[model samples]
Target: MLIWERPEPSARASLSPLSRDRIVRAAIKLADADGLQAVSLRKVAAVLDAGPMRLYRYVDTKEELLDLMVDAVYGEIPAPPPEGDDWRAEVRSLVRGIRGAALRHEWFADLLGGRPHLGPAALGHLDATLTALRSAPGIGDDPDALMRALQAVNGYVLGAVRHEIVELRAERASGLTEHQWQAAAGPYLARAFAAGRYPALAHVVGNGSHQDPAEMFDAGLDVLLTGIAAGA
Candidate 1:
């Protein structure tokens, strides 16, 4: 069973009393500063000024700690279960809420959609979203359509967020803005474009306007939502 499924143990009185929340928050801080690779039970215990084994009382393994961290992120994303009658708008709200949380916690995008999020906060957010979608015009009552819509939209979110984080981290690591990086690669791109075999790719790169990440995400989401809306 997941940690969330179990009742939380009370903190034992001591100089540094331990609770699951304290351990999870410390783990989150580690992940936020140095990414998921930095998180571990020992590290979290160290943050709490407690020995590693003490954390085992609340969290059994590293995986359980990660599960808690993901659920903590979900706690940050909450939207009203029902928002007027616009299913598209409602979904847009939920997606953007998720995006906002990811931006705040870059490592969050890495873990999200990577596993079954059965934690209370995750289930709460999901339940609210599906309930909102239940009011969607035509397909609301149809479980199959709802599931399809959920899967498609979530797939897009996972892929898009992963790409965005990759780019963002690449920029940070290389010490160059995306535009500067692109400019640095201009020669290689020019050579590729010169090859007549790649005409479509060349044309788009030559004439397509660059989009701010937020704008790109919004535009892509709308395109996707429009397709879903057609069935919606």
Candidate 2:
């Protein structure tokens, strides 16, 4: 049974009043403030003003707590429209919501895909994605095709968001804007380009306009959706 499904034991009424939701929220708060490494049963209990052993009544282990935390954040993502929403647009919205969540909880990207998320909130998000895919105008009832398209979009979002979070963390750590960092590295890149080992990269890097991260993400999503349409 999922952690949320298990009933809280009645014997723990004498201890600090705690539920799985409270513990999960406390953990998320700790993670958001200090990253995933800062989160632990002891730390969360302290945050709740309870003993470490009191938390075991709600969650058995730290890993289970992490799972709950991930799902709780997933619950924050907006659900797709019930009617008249284009599949491609829904996919875009879904991914953007995930990106926003990752930005809000910097530690979220680390735990994503770390384990199966059977929690109700995570399963609801998955169901919403599948519902949109199935409702696509051209996508018939081929489960295999639907699964492939879902996987492709999911794979792209995970990779893109992971890179974004890494760069964001680096920027935070270095206290340098992306443009400043690029400018600092410009001379080294110029030297490498002058060596002429990669003409195509040199040409693009030298001449191409810098695209904002959102634009890049949208462009990739457009390409992915186009490919899915063609295949459909």
Q: Which candidate is the best by TM-score?
A: 1
Compared with the true structure, what per-residue lDDT tens digits does model 1 show for residues 1-232?
6566687877678999998889889999999999999999988888899999988889998988888899899998876555578777788888888888888899999887755699888888787767766676667679998888788888888888889988889999999998899889999989887877589888888999878888888899889878877777
The total number of steric clashes, by the backbone 3 Å criterion, in model 2 comes to 0
Stretches off by above 4 angstroms in model 2 are 10-16, 82-85
Report the Cα lDDT for residue 78, model 1.
71
Candidate 1: residue pairs that collide = none
Q: What root-mean-square deviation over C-alphas does model 2 reach? A: 2.0
Question: What value does the lDDT take at residue 188 in candidate 2?
Answer: 89
- Give, for candidate 1, the lowest lDDT window spanning 10 residues: 78-87
Show where candidate 1 strays beyond 4 Å.
80-82
